[model samples]
Every structure is written in structure tokens, then in C-alpha cells.
Target chain A: MSFRLALQESPGNPWFSWRYVQDNSDTILAALREHAILTAEAMLIATAVAVPLAVVAYWYRPLTGPILALSGVLYTIPSLALLAFVAPYVGTTNPGSVLIALVLYALLLIVRNSLAGLNQVPPEARDAAQGMGYGRWGRLFRIDLPLALPGIVTGLRLATVSTVALVTVGALIGHGGLGDLILTGFRNNFYKAEILTGAVLCVVLALVLDLLLAMAGRLLTPWSRRAVR
Target chain B: MRSENPIQQALTWLNDPLNWTNPGGILDRLGEHLWISAAAVALGCVVAWPIGMWLGHAGRGGSLVVLISNLTLAIPTIALLTILPLTFLGFGKPPVVVALAVFAVPPLLANAYTGVRSIDPEARDAARGMGLSGWQVLGRVELPLAVPYLAAGFRTASVQVVATAALASFVNGGGLGQIISAGFGLGISVGGGQILAGGFLVALLAMLVEAVLAVVERVVTPKPLRKARGRAARRAAVATGSA
Candidate 1:
């Protein structure tokens, strides 16, 4: 018991405290779960919005510049500032404001990637589809979108990683998942172990998610693998 | 106050002269924000560029470096800002600058590496064939061609640094974020206008920096490459339109 007290009261506080982890395992796990859910939901909504926007931009030549430019502007806004701007309207009772801001932040990368992916579909391929009597919609779904999948997936990966990072800022308004732990630790006398756990978990989650997405992209586009080989 | 439009109140708050000039005012915070961002980006460039260029020249383990750097993006900025202070670094600007600088490295390093690696082999050969030493070849042929990529990296790093700099206020590293946090401290009823104003200023500043850096990027790019890119863009647009 005295040894534990001595460990706790040591002048050089250790960065990784097993005591802290053992004490607050539930809280840590809950925060990690919340962080993952928030990231997944944000990515889902962002992709849904981004794909249509990218399609519109690709189809309408004149709108492409404006659409890309608008998303670029949105992307430049700081995550915290965007959240604060959004919070007033959404009332911050839920994570609604955080989700909206994340979706906006994510639009640029996904939309750009989707458009690039669409453009990468060879004109010859489209012509072949047309000669085969495929309708415009059919060609788009069968030829264009499939070709674009890799790029769109790449965009999703990038957006998801960034969104995961940005979600921590949501803690400023009390919606930040693991960010809450980091903030609470800071507020409570610079609790190093708690802060490190949150920080490390965020990076781990990001890397694991990124790896999973890359693998999924490979599975989705098996042709890419064959071409490389 | 409850019935009044928040945006209108925000505009009024922005227009107030006292908010612009007083101690810890908008101007002061903006200065702090710019100072931290500029310092961070400069430091990032200093540390990342040399290593990136060396690795690119060496042509071994460069991708691994880039991958590792990109992985750094996953590390939460808030966590870094908050956690750094716990070390001997102590509170305020040190932690903020270090965190922002770390954030800036991935882009700068990746771009620098790609910029050098992307150079045409024949051009490098021609420079070498012209009796240029290894260092001379790099300086005269490689560096000039890499300007566009470096500019792109700089622009990305600067814009991101500026935007992320707002979090500096969290660690007592004063900036535009202070206004936002201060407004939050005052509660929505009393500080709605201030919050809106703060957000607006930060967004405006970030956009302005992006625009300025974009223009700078255009100016710095080699003239022939710029024209070629412009032509390619036009061709792409035409192709897409006809399709």
C-alpha cells in the first residue's frame, strides 16, 4: 500500500501508469468506443454527400470549379472554429454539430478523389460500353464507378484519418470522444498517463482504420493488384 | 438578446473599435496566431526539407519516411498540444509551436521528397554530362525543377498551421482561439456574438492565407511548366465536357 502511495506521489510522475489504466479501464474503453463511432458516422455521411457532389461536378463542366473551390474554402476552416460556428445552431445537446462540421471538412478530399477517379476511366472504355448498348446510367455504374472505386476509397481513407484527428477538437464543446479524457487529464493536474493513453489510442485507431481501408480498397479493386503484378 | 439574430450581434461585435485595438484584442490575437503559425511552418521546413531532400537523393527508405510522416497525421492535435506541456517544455507557446510544427512536417517532408524524385532522369543526366559536380547538379538542375512541389508543400503547411494554430489558446498559447474559448467561457447567452466573430475571423484568416499562398505558388512555378499544366487542365475540361 505504501509502495503504491510512493509511486503515486513520486516527484517524477511516470508517463505510462498501469495504475491509471487499471483504475479507469471502463472510462478509457467507453471513450475509445465513442471516438470510433463518431468517426465512422462522420465518414459515412461525408462519403454519401461527397460522391453525389463529385458526380455533379464531373457531369457539369461549369460547376466543377465552383464546387471544388467551395469545398476548398470549407476545408481551410479550423476544426475548432467550424465546430464553434456550428454549435450555436445545433445546440450541442448531441454530436450533431460535430458531425456537420466533419462532413464539411471531409468533402474536399473525397470529392476531389472521386472526380479524379471518374476522370481516370478511359474514353475507350466508355465508348466500348456505349457500343455494347449500355445506357448512360448503366455505363456510369458499371464502368465509370468501378474504375473510380480505388480513388474514392483512397479519399475515404484520407478523410477518415483526418476526421478522426479532428473529432478530438469536438471535446471543446463536450462531444470530443477521447478528447474528453485528454482535456479532463489536463484540467486535473496534468495527468500524464491519461493524456498519453488518449493520444496513443487516437493514433492507433487512425493507423488501424487506415490499414483496414487500404485492405478494403485492394479487395474492391482486384484488377489493380493484377496490373501491378 | 435571445430574440436578436446571432450573426447580426457578431457583426456588431466585430465592428467595435475596442475589440480591434485593446489589449488582448482581435489584432493582438491575430498577431499571436500569425507569429506561432509562421514560426512553426518555418521550423518545419527547416527540419523536414533537408532530410527529405537527402532521402530523395539517396533513393532508399524515402517511402518509409513519407509513410511514417503521414502516419503522424493520425496523432490528435489537441492531445499533442495538451500533452507536450506536461514534459519539461512547460506551458504556453513551446508546446503549441512544437505540436503545430510536428503537424506541418508530413506535408513538407512528403512534398520535398516527391519534388526531387519527380525530376526527369534525362535532365539530371544532362546536368551531370555538362561537367557539373554532384552538388552542382542538384543545385542547378534538381532544385529549380522542384520549386513547384516545395511551394505546394509550403502552401499546405502554412494554411494548415494557421488553422491549427487556434488550438494554441488551449495551452495558454494565445491566438484567435482565445476569443472563441473566451466566448465559450461567457456562455452562449452572453457571448454568442463573440463566438461567431471569433469563428469568422479564423475562417477568414485561413482562407486569406490560402489565397495568398496560392498566388505565391503560381508566381514561383516555372513558367513553361505552369503553361503546360494550364493547357492540360483546359484539355481535361474540354474532354470532360464533350463526354
Candidate 2:
């Protein structure tokens, strides 16, 4: 059937339409793919930055307050405003702008959680590790990091989920993956099918990512699970 | 304007005295932004706080709190803002308020539940032993102790509401976002200044609200709790040094 004929078969402004889904599956998948990739890239970079920053803060207690306060200030800036501010420097159409903004937004949770996790490492564990002749770096890897894994993972999960949600706002700059579809659907006569599809997929992506991270956290910290039993 | 640096252009736009006094000026938009944020956060408190407190007091609905927090994380604010106006709610402030209220609920609810749940069991027992009714225990003892958590929640909700309310302009709901959106409409080269100015205003407002609420949080927290926290911090410092 011709595209025009297929369009006519759908009722006016239905919230969902099988026809629309079938006809636009390629477009929908592309948007979803972009959204997922963007989120993953942003999270990867953010984790890399946050872990080291948090480690430094943990090592030098004096820097802890300022590090956290800076992230806290960054977190408070509205996503739209942050994006706008970044857009001028990076160019609006560049996905780099979104990636940079997302990373900044993710820093607070990951850094806070990382520091908290490090602090939670029992002092006795550190002392014991040191007594066993482990170097400072070796002790951090073997004793402290493993103990702090759960808290750090929790921060990653929170950051990933929020980044997924915020990525849609990147549509304002023309690169918001699923966000582009949602905004387009809104602008184009309130196309309910497209809008609902975009919204539902964003949530599903978030839920799926969160569950995967939680499971990964469990697997990475098997001793914690064993202790519960 | 094109010859000038973007920062210079933005400053010029911001400096325009006429922009302040004219209808739909910065002051007008700021008032709208504040009103919309306050209404949504107030509505959220009215709906979520009681439920959170009640469930927390009973020590039930732990899973529900988890569910709500996850849902809040998953749902995009932009999607909610756009979708609500399409429903029977139609356009304008009502849908914006509803959407923002939904946005505000999770932090408020989660914090409230956590605040109540964090209360020491011994405190509850002691209050009960002293002949306080269940309601009295919740009101006089539990609530007072939970003030810090509640205040933290309020601070979070308020700051978030203020930020997300900027999205209300998407549905023709009034707010400072109009400035940003309008600038976007004017194209980047021409409207760059306006966009920058809008971003600065929104960020400043959010930080101001956060700072103000933080003070409120400190003031509301009982003195004993404050002193105890300070002591704990000092102890932590000593322990860290020893380690």
C-alpha cells in the first residue's frame, strides 16, 4: 500500500497505532540507538572522571568539601540552562555539547557516591592490608575499592538513569536522540503515536539500564551477597 | 551585534533598561517562573508528604518508595511536559503545574520516608513508654527528629521544581524559559545573547533557591541534632588522621 493510503487508515490522533509503528520502525530504532549510545558514552566518560576525582578527594580530606560543593553547584544548574551555556562554546548542533553537559551533570552523583564508598571502607581493613605488606596503591585496589564497589555502583546507576532522562532535553539543540522524535511529534500536530512511543522507550531504556547495573553490582561484589546469606 | 562578542552582546541585552520595564521583561518572567515553581512544589508536598510520612511511620510501602524513585528517574521531564498538554488538561499553566508536581514528588516522597525510617527505634520506644499516643509520638518526637530529612527533601524539591519549570515554556506555559526559547527562535547568531542571558538568569535563580533552602534546613534542624552532627564530623576527621 502507498504511504498516503496507510496514513488514512489510521484514526485521527490515536495515542497508539500499529500502522505507524510498522511504517516508522526504522526511524524509531535509529532514534533509540542514538539515545542508548549517547547515554553509554556519557556515562563511560563521566565514570572515568568521577572515580579519579573522588579518589583524590578521599586521599586529601581538605579537597573533599570543595570537590563536592563544586559538583553540587553543577548539579543545581538546570539542564536546559547548562546545555544553553555549553552550546555557545561547543556549537549547538554538535553532540559534543550534549556529551559534555551530561558528563557534568553525572559528576555529582558518581563523585559523591565514590567518596562515600571509599569512606565506608573499614579502617581496620586498611590497617590489616598495610600490615600484610601491601603498598598503598595495592591496598586501595585490593581492600578499599572492592569494599566501596556497592556504593560506587549505586552512584553509576543513578547517574546513568538521570543521563538517559536528560538526553531528551538535548533535542533542543537538534541532537536529542529519542528527544528529537518526541519534540518533532509534539511540534507536528501532536502526533500521539510517535510521542507515546518516544516517551515509553525512554522509560524502558532507563529501567533496563538500571536493572543491568544493579545486577552487575551484585555480580561484582559477590562477597556482599554471600555475607547476606 | 554580530561584530560584538557574544558575551558583550548578552551584557548589552541584559543592560537594556527598557527590557526591565517593558511587558514580558526579565522581571515579569522571573515572577512567572517563581509562581509556577512554587505552585507545583506546594501541590507535590500536599500530595506526597502525608503518604510518605504515613507509610514511613507504619514501616510499610518500602517497595513503593523504590518504585516511585525509579519511575521518576526513568520518565523524561520534557516528555511529561509535552504529553500533559496534549491530554484533556490542554495547554497552559494547569498541565505545567501537574507535570512539575509529578517531577517534584519523588524527592519529596523518598526523603520523607527516609527521614521517618531513619528515626532510632529506641526513640520511638522511649516516647511510647512516656505515655505518648501513637499520634503524639509521630508528631512530637518522630517529626521533630525527622526535620533535617524533610528540610533536605524540600530543598531538593524546590530547586528541582525551579529548574524544570523552565520547560513549562514548551507548552506555552509562562516562565523564564520563554526567554531562552524565544532566543532560539531568533536563530543563534542573532539570539545568542538572549539565550545566554536566559541561561544565566535560570542558573542564578536555582542557586539562590538552593542557598536559601540550605539556610532554612540548618535553622529548622534541632540544635541537639546539629551539635551531634558536628561531633560526628570531628570524630570522623580524627579517625581519618589515625588511619
Candidate 3:
């Protein structure tokens, strides 16, 4: 039985002719893996920068207003346009360029949340901590952070979901993800089933990723339960 | 065409009367774009409300529903548009509508669920104590309270769906997206202008919808909260004077 026949015969079968589609599947999956890694990388970098900057912003509110406003403006740039603008700078199709764009996008969400979460740690709480003789760092970690955990996690979850969706667009520049399958299926007008498969897989992946993140939120932020309740 | 430089030629091409008509031409297309987005949002609400209500009433696994909604938002609109026509065929409004609905649902669902869940326990208990049946309590007590939150969700979903549907033009689904995508293909100042015009129109429409929804939300919000905020302001002023 030929690979084509197998795909045709079992159009709905995710595993149909797995070996023949191995290269293509790998390309798609590898793109997805790279997307995950890129988001994780961007999150780490952005969080590291955003957390300290948030503290600075909190301490010197007037000075950080311009920066925050700039980030808000940057957030309005259509995602694809930003990617296209960066294409020339980094040369098109480079994963690094995509990651750079993702990092900028993530920064807006991360920074906003970091600031909001910090602000949410009531002024009185900070005053109380100070009066308790805890140093700023100690107070930040012990009291403020725990209180702000739910908001911070909410921001992270939002950023991660948006990143997952945007990374699929990276497929347009030859970075293959499940989106590559969908795009290729459309471009060639071949194998409608393949397109369906890709779309379904993309939806499934999103749902699973969301569930995992929600679980993580539940676990990491003990305070989230209180918020939910 | 041959004598002119690329920029000049592109500008000349764009200045063609057929393409560059007056206010009427632009307004007609703009109207069509607005209609499509508005219709899609309405359709999404119609579709989302039942599901949102069901999830909210069930009350168990409310967080899970919100999580799913967040993920639904994560499914990039372009990817969904690109994929929709493959299996569905017939490349026009239906696919665009479906895609927009998909984009719209998450916010709607999340808002509905949140609104329902956020109701004050005493209010819910009071309704129950009054011998209101479960359905009656939900319809009367819960939904009224949830209106502002749901409206907030609707406002978010409306803007999101409108912007996303504009991208449907990439699939030949004809909305503002066609103008922008063609502009991109033109790849010059002319293309840039067209894209800008199309994008600006869409953004304007989104802003208008947001403002309209803001008004609607204010109208729909419960009176108690408004009163509470008023009281808080007065108290704060009193405290400031004392200090």
C-alpha cells in the first residue's frame, strides 16, 4: 500500500502513513518545539529584566511612566508587521529574529503584570513589612511576592498563550509548526485532510498547553485559590 | 510606466481613479468592513452565551473553562483562517464568520464565567432563601450581577474579532484585509498608504465599538457598585481632610 493511499483511506487517522510523512511531521513538530523553547527563553529573559525594572518603576513611579507608555505603544504594533519589520534587520527566516520579536511582545505583558502585581501589594503591606525590620529584598520575597503571585502568574499565562499562537505565524518564513502543515496544505492545495489534521492538532495543542499552565498556576500560586474562590 | 521610476510608477498606479475614488468609494468599503465585523461579533455572542451560561451555572471547573478560553485566544487568527478553507472550501464570508466566532468565544466565555462566579454569596443565598428555584435564581440574581463583567468580555471580544477578521482577507475572504494584503503585495509607498488607510479604518471601527460598549457597560452595571464607589470617594475625601 502506497503512502498516498493510506492517507486517503484513513484521512482522519493521525498515524496514517507515519513513516512517509515523518520528515514533514518532524519539521512541524520541531517548529513547535522551537516555539516552546523560544517562548520559555523569552519569558526567562523578560521576567529577569521586568522584575527588577518593575521594582525600579514602583520606587520611582514618575521616571518609569515614559518607559511603560513606550511599551504600551509598542504593544499596539500588529504582530505580523513587527515581524516583517524585523525581517530586514535579522534577515528573514531566522529563528533568532522570531524569538527577538517574541521577546519584545512578551515584555509588554510581563512588565505590565509585574508592575500591576507589585502595585497590588498594598502600600500598607509594604509599610508593615518595613516596620517589621525586614530589609527590602527580604520583604519583597517574603511578603510582597507571595501576595502578588496570582497576578504575576496570570500575566505569565496570558503571555505564554499569546506566544504559542503567534509562533504559528513564524511558519510563513519557512519555520514549520503545526501551522506549517496548515500553510503548506493551503499553498499547494493538496490533501485537505492534512490541513484538517494540522488545525485539529493546533487546537489540541493549545488546549493541552492551557491546561498545563492552569495546573502550574494552581500549584505555584497558593494564593490563586483564594482569588478563584 | 517604462519611463517612470518604481516609486513614481507605483504612485501613479495607486492614483488611478478607479482605485482611488472619493469619499463614497472609501465609505462603502468601510461600511462593508464594519458590517462584517459587527455581524461576526453578534453571531459570536449568540453562539457563546449558551456555552458560557452552561459553564457558569455548572460552577464546578470554572477555572478549567477559563483556561480553555485563554487557550482559544491563543489560536492565532491567521492560522485559523488559513486552515479553514482547506476542508470547508468556498472561500468567502462563512469561513470568515467562523474564524471570527472562534476568536470571539474565549473572551465571551471567560467573562460570562467570571461574572457568574463573582456574584456576592449573600446575594445568591438571599435569592435561594426567597424560594427562587435554581433557574430563577440564575436568571434573576446571577445574570443581573454578571452583566458588567460580561459586557467587559464582550467589549474585548468585539475588538479582537474585528481586528482578526480584517486578517481574513489574506484568505480572499474580502473585508478590510484585502486592502491591506494587496497593499503589502504592492510593496511601495502606494501599498503602504493603502495598508495604512485600511488599518486606520479598522482601528477606528474598533475604537468606536469599544466606546459604544463602554456606554452599554455603564448602563448595564448594577447601581449598588456605583453607589459604593461614590461612598468610597466621599470617605476618602473625608479621610484626606482629617489627615
TM-scores of the models, in the order given:
0.92, 0.92, 0.72
Q: How good is the docking of model 2, as DockQ? A: 0.39
lDDT by residue for model 2 (A1-229), tens: 1123333425687888889889999999999999999999999999999999999999999999999889888988998888778877687678998999999999988888888889989999989999999997998899988999987997898898889999998888778899988888988977988999999999999989989999999999988997645
| Error of model 1, residue B76, in angstroms | 1.0
Q: Which is the leading candidate under DockQ?
A: 1
Give the Å error, residue A112, model 1.
1.0
Question: How many angstroms is residue B31 displaced in model 3 relative to the true structure, after the best TM-score fit?
Answer: 3.8
Which scores better on lDDT, 1 or 3? 1
> lDDT by residue for model 2 over B107-135, one digit each (tens)?
77877787788789999999999999999
Question: Which CAPRI level is candidate 2?
Answer: acceptable
Task: Please report how far candidate 2 places residue B224 from its true position, in Å.
Answer: 1.1
Give the worst 10-residue stretch by lDDT in candidate 2 chain A: A1-10
After superposition, the stretches of candidate 3 with alpha carbons farther than 4 Å from their true spots are A1-20, A23-26, A33-45, A60-101, A119-150, A171-178, A193-229, B1-29, B54-58, B88-90, B124-133, B188-201, B222-243
Clashing pairs in 3: none
**Index of the highest-lDDT prediction:** 2
Fold similarity of candidate 1's chain A to the true chain A, as a TM-score: 0.93
